[model samples]
Target chain A: MSKDKWNDEEIGHWLKSVPKPEDNRSRDDILARLKADPRLRDKQPSRSRKWIPAGVAAAALLAAGILIPSLMDGGGEVSVSDSASESADDAAQTTSESFQSGRSIEQNSAASDEEMSLRSDQSVMEKGLMGAAVYPEAMEGFVPFRIGLVHEATVVPVTFLIPESVVAEDFGSVSPGDAELYNRYASQIDEEALGFDDYHPYQGTVSTDKGGVTLVLSGDHPYDTASASITTFAESVQETFRNEENVLVRDESGAPAEFDQVGALPEIATEPEGVYFAYEKNDGTTVLAPDRRFDPAHAAEAIELMKSRTTDLFEPLIPAEADLIVELPAEGDRMTIRFEEPFDFSRMDDQDAARMIDGIALTAAQYHLRVRLQNAVNPPAGYQLEDVLPLPAGPNGIILSLPG
Target chain B: MDESVFHRIYEEYHQDVYRFLIYLTKDRMLSEDLLHEVYVRVLKSFGNFQGKSSERTWLFSIARNVAFDHFRRSSVRRKRTDESFDWETEQPADRGLTPEEAAVHGDDMDRLFKVLDDCTEDQRMVLIMRFLQELSIAETAEVLGWTEAKVKTTQHRAVKKARELLEGMDGWGGGGR
Candidate 1:
């Protein structure tokens, strides 16, 4: 459109002229597809009926746990334990009653839906715990202490949740080796007390710095080799110190290791839940590992951090060399990713490309956002997404099999 | 929605949805597939449709999602040995002349689309919605889930970029005017 300066009116006129191909298919084709969609079928009654009892059963099981504590404490008002047990019992009773009444069909259906949603949430959490070999014997009374992985410049923290029994008052008074030993024992209890499946003693040195803690790991294996345990310990030590600015994980030489190193002291703060990292295992299966500190709110920023390839466990699907530029929608549920020159995907084999896309998609999916690749080269067969790119469903579809 | 209601919606909006997908994908075959997927989603989720947005806006939003899903799924599929695959290859020859060629053949509309391909996806989306779809800034923002300011800024930038691209083309002299 010709104008002194191009305007919206002219642009609109020009755009309207773009050829819109004819749709030869009749309305019958669409009606046929709609009919074929099983989701539109009349299966709600059966599905809703199945979940009602399941919800009741779950609530009863929870009530059973509550009953145990009250029964153990016995009947005495003066006993603090007895009062705590009574309150737990009351809460459980309320929950059970709520599940029992299905006054209206709509209300019943809604309750059933809530139960199904809760079950799905539990499954996701269990999947998130896939790689972790939890030592329930040691962790019985321990509460999760979350430590933020603060990126110094932006003060954006990725929090890691660690289980701990007691918080240490002083790290300065103890030797580095002693502090490590004390923290490990305090968190996991005495080695002799631990069951066979409990995690082993620390194989790393811990030292305190100015408002920060430094971990000098001695093991030959990378941090990711025992990612769940190593990260759990790192989080615990950070939690123990009150003035921790950052937690630094280091090699023996005292220099920052390329992967999962450079721990500063703690600046312990909690963010809203739903923090996750996309990490690939040795077996090549990529899994979404949830962290209390990995905030999804800073997903755009977190995605940029992933590009640095900082963690041993997590790798960026988009190659490190690629110049990634992202545009996040104002609502924050969708993102547009553009890669500049040297971001070639044409040379990658099908598996590598799929892995790359999976990493990007899984990370974005954690935040409930879909990603569109703006300038991706060599998209897979049957896909031509130079424009209007959409993310596929995340690989969370694969059922996570926990390590035996 | 019931089949009869869905049939009415299909009759009312299918052409617009199909056209939008065609513009976004530049592949008629793929756009056709996405059009069906969009309706399938619409059919499944119709009960949840609160009428908070216009039917047209909702349909376009669904179309956009369907197209993106197509890109994602296609990217993950095992590679085929299509030696003919080339990133720079012009729009399929069977699809008829590209906008640039159409512009040379005295089609002003094609010329605009040719210039549009040079803009970023966000810019292009804003331009298409605001101009060709003739959606108001508020409507465009609503459909895109972007702020009105974002829509305005993106529209401004898109026009500037398209002007630059057009200026560079041979025999360009405000053909639309």
Candidate 2:
């Protein structure tokens, strides 16, 4: 092995050994940066509009397009103009000249503009509805009174919708986001009255950034008693944050959260498990719950699994007298469940029926099936059950709009 | 473009492009900044994509252009003439000690990249796309807008240059595999 005569094949193999660098920033972070750039927006075609709210996008345009162009106009450390000045014989654009532009005039410090717009992107996100975490469209204009309710050992999430009118009373037109709402109302939520385990305003600091929520759990945070507790805590977080996809669980000192049994956990990815069933809170309040650990075989098996009481933890969503048959769609993805007797959801409480509908729809969703409930058409969550019901955006929704 | 479509493209290609930018710039913050530029340009001009090249190659082309633009804008132009850009991208940023650098300190790769720094821009691009990214010779040619022969020639020269540089250092002693 002569060092002097090392071959190309050896070099090629060693180059492959250079490990691919880790990219930690989430998709949301990149999107935030994209939304923050005005050049993209200025060139955006009209048909592609309205994905983001007009107000947020306008604010983004203002921050990126305005307020900082002159500040960076040749005023920064020398990266652009001074360096390229030495190159007197800069060649013609032989490659990708279509994307290229005049060096000096076009170099308006776009990189510096990026840092500015990223800081403003947070303000853009905070302007979105506080309850966008659960269902953005349905919960917009209402602040969330979210509580992580305990049902047996399961953490059942319940969000009370705080109407904008009520928010304006104290905060005056500027509705406080999750942190403020948590601070102001969390202590007062009667957990015993709500039938929860008194876990309100999580014993942690919840903050937001370009990459979704960062939950800083306290030293004695109570989320990690078991795998069930971990699942619920993490899932409950999904229901609580604006963007559930990127919840980073940090310790008190901001290191990635490490639980007692589970050695080290960096972040929580909230994915729906198999068939959801009914569970009752400590105060006998019923909520749709999923056995997050269980993996049901298929849609039919899930339907069967949902009917029988799994344990003291999970109860049957379907009534004991009700008998239903899972009817697979001929060509489409929607599963049809036809009921024989006691299938009338009209007899159940409106909210209970809603939860049942939600649970069934959610179970169907786990197997990539949309549910078209044949007999339960007029179930109480306000959507027409006669139609093919898509998966519920979430579970256990209860709005608490302040009275006028 | 639909945000969902943009998001899909971003998810699929963002990591590879980010790593490519990091290898080009060696500074995480600058890579991120350049990544932003790449994505912004991508989203703006995505409608123009003709689908002639694979989506991966298309993204790499855009990323290579973005890195080149950053060099043109930044002080990297001072090291060489317009035709030959001697990439002076030394000293990875302290903020993000990439897992690659942290895990492979004093390894062959550490020395390889150091030697690669002395290679020309064309050679660097060919070596990265061909070997690091595992793209074929034709795909690397598509990204750099060069003929396959040119890509092969550059790759050969780049590897030989890297070996020669490594041979000069006392400790290299010619690695076995």
Candidate 1 Cα RMSD after full superposition onto the native fold (Å) = 22.0
Docking class of 2: incorrect
Q: Which candidate leads the pack in DockQ?
A: 2
lDDT of 1 by residue, B1-177 (tens): 478768778778888788777667665555666676677667756776799999888888888766654443233221122323222332233345545334333355456557666777788798778776778999899888889999999988988887677666634553434
Candidate 1: TM of chain A?
A: 0.31
| Candidate 1 structure quality by residue, lDDT tens digits, A1-404 | 45445555665565666665567777786677556543345432222221223222111111211111211112111111113234333534443443344222112112111222123222111112111111112122222222221110011111111212122222344433324533543332211111011122334665765645566767563333222223444444443342345556666676654433223312222112223445543223233443333323456765665555433334455556777787888985778778766455668744355445545654565465677787677754322345433332222221111111
lDDT of 2 by residue, A260-378 (tens): 64567788654445467777543334556665534444678878777765343467777767788898777778899888653666788544565566677767866667888776544
Per-model TM values vs. the true structure: 0.40, 0.39
Look at candidate 2 and give me any clashing residue pairs. A79-B73, A79-B74, A80-B73, A160-A400, A161-A399, A161-A400
